[model samples]
Each structure stands twice: as C-alpha cells, then as structure tokens.
Target: MKINGEVTTGLGKAAYFLSQEFYSLEFERNLGFVPFPGTLNVVVSDDYLDEINEIKNNCQNLIKPDEGFGAVKYIPAKLCDEINGAIVFPAKTTHEENYLEFIAENKLRDQMNLKDGDIVSLEF
Candidate 1:
C-alpha cells in the first residue's frame, strides 16, 4: 500500500543519499486483516513518518497471532504517547466486512493522516 508518510531528512546529501539506499526492518506481525509492507512502499516525504511510527506502535500492541487459526487478534494500547497522534481515516469502517473486502482488494494499511506515534483503532 502507498504510505502517505515521510522521508526523514534535512536539506542535504545525507537525506537524499539515504533515500537512494535500502534498509531492513522488523515486522511485529499482522495487526488485523490489513497487510504490512512486504517491501518498503516508497517513502513519500518525513512529512508523515511520525504518523507511520505511531500507527506501527498502535497496531503492534493490538495484534497477536491467533491461537489455533493464526488470524490477527485485537489488544488495545494506552494512548498517551506525548507526541500528538492522528487516528486512521474511516475508522469505523475498517471493521465492517464490506470494508474488509475492500481493504483486501486494494491492499491497505492505516490511512490516518498522522505523525510518528499515532493510533488507528480497529473496532471489533
């Protein structure tokens, strides 16, 4: 999915230079039916990396591997991270079956216009 987030850098070769390189990261697991990046989606702009980190934290806390079936599970996190975080857009709809289907078809992640450390609530 296209993450409308940041490219963390200052006006210099360090920032742009870094962008041209590759890196590896750890995935905590699925927070829900939504898929995490199999590979990095192009870093859009640090314009919103803060938001990405926020959602990542929230989603990581909420997700657990299902005991028998291995589906995603829900566990909530305390939301007082000090950094201002934005909730994902169409929050309520993410839980709806129809919306889930849409998410599956489109392949999605938190669409919240957030900063690094935001929360995206998925109602069960």
Candidate 2:
C-alpha cells in the first residue's frame, strides 16, 4: 500500500519521547535501528482517512513504552520510494486523525531535503 501527504511541522514533543533509552532500545530491537531523535510529520488529505485507519487497525509491530509513556504501533515503510522508515501511530497523541508520523534511522527532512508543504510518498 502507498500513501502520500504534505510535510508539516509537529508540536516539537516527539523528540523527547523518541530519545528515551527504553524506546530507543525497543526500536533498535524491532526495527534494526534506533530512530532519529524526531519524527517527520505528514498531513494527509481527508480522502485517505479510511485507509489510514485501516493501516492503524492492522498494524502489528507494537512498541510498548515504559512507565508514564504510551504505546505505539508501526509498520515498515519507505519514504519517497527511497529512504527506509516506518509509519508510527502512538496510542496517545494530540494529533488529529489525518496526521501521520514517520521515523527513520536519520533525520528525514535533512536527508530528503524536505520542507513544510513539500509532498512526499510512503510505500509499505
């Protein structure tokens, strides 16, 4: 499956959670790499809401967080048909339904030269 969306800025909160030792260890164990200390936020159009929900419902790769943190589920995905990454869905998030969070081994924005409003594709 594939989904496309425009790059957007996040609430600047993901880095703290992502940088935690417990989460980093879990990511390394499950995904083979510790994610970059942040996430790439993508805002998909309403047209894909159903598909997004479907993906979230079917996702099986779950990362259980330590105390005081929420769990997250992810599915391996490719960013812009090139970079390796995953689409992560947090069990608790302030984001709306249309927002998608992506994590990779490196900073995706820098690696892809992406800026807010840039359109990108994710292939699973």
Candidate 3:
C-alpha cells in the first residue's frame, strides 16, 4: 500500500509526503511521480508538470504572478533505520494576494465571466 503523509509547509502548493513507505517507488507513484527509488525520487512528466503549474500560477494566493509558477526545488529524502526518503518543494513560491482578482484591466475576466466569487475549478 502507498503511504501518503501530511502536507508540509513552504513547498508551494499542496505538498503531501510519502513516509515510512516513501521512496518505495510503488508508494510515490500513486501521487503521479515516476518512482525512482534508486534516487529516492520520482520523475514528474512534462504533461503532468505543465497542467499542475498552470493551476498553481493562477491561484492568486498559492502562487504570485510575479513569481510565476513555483519551481520544484528539491525532493527531500530521509533515512530511517536504514531506509532513505525525500521531500519535494517548489524552487520559487510567492503569495500574490489573499484573493484572486481575475478582472484585469483588459476585460479578461469579463470576457471569461470570471468575476468575484466565481470559482475556476480544475481536475487532475
């Protein structure tokens, strides 16, 4: 079975972890990363990253427009007893605003009908 951990802070976006069974290839892959147990990491496919990055970049408070999409910094791996595991984080992450102001000066929001309280949801 896969082991998913609690969300860690400062990793940008939601960063759940794989613990105990983390770095176990089979476990991490459940979260969309290609398990590379040898390196205690997973390979995030380009398609996957792009889709995820887009949403993160748009989420006003999650990632600021200035900071752009938060980059993947490092996958933290820890050794327990004799096992090694890692954690992943965004290379750059900044909070833009508490609220997502979709209505830009160019009527972008109006064109898309994305006004306040309008939820632009996504699916993985």
Candidate 4:
C-alpha cells in the first residue's frame, strides 16, 4: 500500500522518545533496526485518512511503555522506497490523526535531504 505525505516539523521530541531504551529496544525487535534517535514527521494527504485509520484499526500490538513513559504503536513502512522504517504513534502525541512519525535506522532528514514541506511517499 502507498500513502502520500508532506514532510513537516514536529514538537522536537522525537529524539527524546527515540532514545528511550524501551522504545529503542521494542523498535529494534519489531522493525529490525534500532532507529536513529529521531523521527521524520509527515502530514499525510487528506485522501489517505481512511488508509491511516485502517492501519490503526489493524494494529494488534502496542509498544507498551515503562513506568512514567508514554506508549506507542509500530506500523511497518518503507520511506522513499529505500529506507526501512516504521510509523510510530505515541499515545501522548500532539499530532493529528493524519500526521505520522517515522523512525528509521538512518537519519532520514540527512539521508533524504528532506526539509519542511518536502513531499514524500510511504509504502506499507
């Protein structure tokens, strides 16, 4: 499946969330890589809202957080057809439903040369 989106800025907490041992370890187990200590925030196309909801509906597992930590879910994804990653949804996230947070083994912003407003695509 494919979803179109535009890169966007986040609340600047991806590094903190990604660095937590609980999230890092769970991400490695689920996505096959310990993601770079950050995420690529994307504002998905409005047309893909249903698809995004479907993914959330089908999510059977949760990345349960340790005490005092927030929760998240992992959804497998491929970014720009090259980087392997997972879309993460934090339980305490401030983003809207159409906003997705992607975590990969590499620094996606640098690797893809992405900046705010850059269009991107994701495959699941």
Candidate number with greatest lDDT: 2
> Candidates' lDDT values, in order?
0.25, 0.91, 0.29, 0.86
TM-score of each: 0.22, 0.96, 0.21, 0.93
Model 4: ten consecutive residues of lowest lDDT: 52-61
lDDT of 3 at 107: 25
Residue 4 miss distance in model 3 (angstroms): 20
How do the residues 30-117 of candidate 1 rate in per-residue lDDT, one tens digit apiece?
Answer: 2222322221122233555565445444663222222322222223221222212122212222221211111111112333333433
7-70 per-residue lDDT for model 2 (tens digits): 9999989999999998889889988899999999999889998888988998888988889999
Candidate 3 wrong stretches, greater than 4 Å: 1-12, 15-68, 94-124
Q: How does model 3 fare in lDDT?
A: 0.29
Best by TM-score: 2
Q: What is the C-alpha RMSD of each candidate to the true structure, in Å?
A: 15.8, 0.9, 18.8, 1.1
Model 2 residue 70 lDDT?
Answer: 97
Residue range with the least summed lDDT across 10 consecutive positions in model 1: 98-107
In candidate 2, list every pair of residues with a backbone clash. none
Predicted structure 4: clash tally: 0
Number of clashes found in candidate 3: 6
